[model samples]
Target: PDILHQLVKGTFKDHLVEWVGKYLEQVHGKTGTKNILADIDQQIAAAPPFPGLWCFPDGHNFSQWTGDNSKALMKVYLSAIEGHIPDDVEHTFHAFLEFCYIVRQNVIMDQTLAELRDALAQFHQYQEIFRMTGVCFDFSLPHQHSMLHYDLLI
Candidate 1:
């Protein structure tokens, strides 16, 4: 199901990030949103130097987001949003990142497949936060639908 564009890029950037931003604004008014988002940006920008990881000085405020950019952001975003957002919301992103990384593995074992299934389940469960928060009205998106088959495909 075109994991790169559908699962990684679409799910993470188009959906989750956008939903989280809206959720933040919903919970915190305009001013609070700015300060909280700035804190997230600072956390992202301050990510320690790593060989392959790229830094985002402006967090996810960039104009364009590619598959690579989303993948890189997944590496650090969970930590950045840990305390700022609800535990359910944080765990939803956690499950998503876990699912994405597990799917990206070149060689898949049965145990990993089980883990993949569990992560997907957790993601679906916690993702209700978006709907409940009114950040997103529907999650019946093609990319989300595609995720249902990822475990079977592997």
Candidate 2:
């Protein structure tokens, strides 16, 4: 996952920036594509990795590369060139940043929810024991609080 993230952050971003630059140059003029591409490449390369709790599934999934997130990023770049979105390169780059942030948040929330579900299942499994002893054995308070913090962050 770390290697995949690095590849996406480095090579994938580089290729996408080049592709978008060529697209803008063709649709609009070749006036600012170079600068825009450079800025986009720098921003993407500098962006932080996804949060640790977020797990990328292990397998080949084309949609992972070519999904609505990628489409929205392309749309934002095109819109900026066509004067629909703000034309500034920074504004277009911010769209990418926002997309990454959203993806990270969604991943974290999904993971947290899955964990909560598992915890509930375990609680159900141990309910009989608690009733017999009149006490709950599960006492991971710090872990529970961390999950609450994650919930609040989400």
Candidate 3:
């Protein structure tokens, strides 16, 4: 679970930054994705712990990273990117989150083929996740979970 947790956090953080970057760059034409994410992360990190709530711009309280509200975190992240609520991003964001939930649930189910298929199907929506992460079709070197640990520690 610890390894899986780390992979989830590491991979999704990278994915979050990349996906947000692509979306913003598409809309605003070469916005600084790295700077934006860094600023947002710093802002979130610097919040004063009062009432034990991490208040985002969209009003979601980010208390935990791993839970039912993981998708909400992604939405908050997207909101941070543009400093505005996206009109139609909610549905797409929810779909992505649902896919992540399915992946996590499948891992818990001990490698069932049905769950694997569902997870793979959802991957189609995440072309950016794959492209930005350099994940290959075969999930080989410089891709795949096998190489994640080495890079993550650095």
Query: Top lDDT: which candidate number?
Result: 1
What ordering of candidates by lDDT runs from best to worst?
1, 3, 2
Point out the worst 10-residue segment of candidate 1 by lDDT: 60-69
Model 1 pairs in collision: none
Model 1 lDDT on a 0 to 1 scale: 0.89
Which candidate would rank higher by lDDT, 1 or 2? 1
Clashes (backbone N, CA, C under 3 Å), per candidate, total 0, 0, 0
Off by over 4 Å in 1: none
lDDT tens per residue, model 1, 1-154 = 5988887788988889888889999999889999999999899999998998889988878888887888888888888887999999998998988998898899999999999999999999999988988888888899898999988888
Report RMSD (Å) for each prediction in the order shown.
1.2, 19.9, 8.9
Best by TM-score: 1
In model 3, where is the ten-residue run with the lowest total lDDT? 145-154
TM-score of each: 0.94, 0.25, 0.40
Task: Assess the local accuracy of residue 47 in candidate 1 as a C-alpha lDDT between 0 and 100.
Answer: 95
Candidate 1 local lDDT, residue 150: 87
Clash pairs of candidate 2?
Answer: none
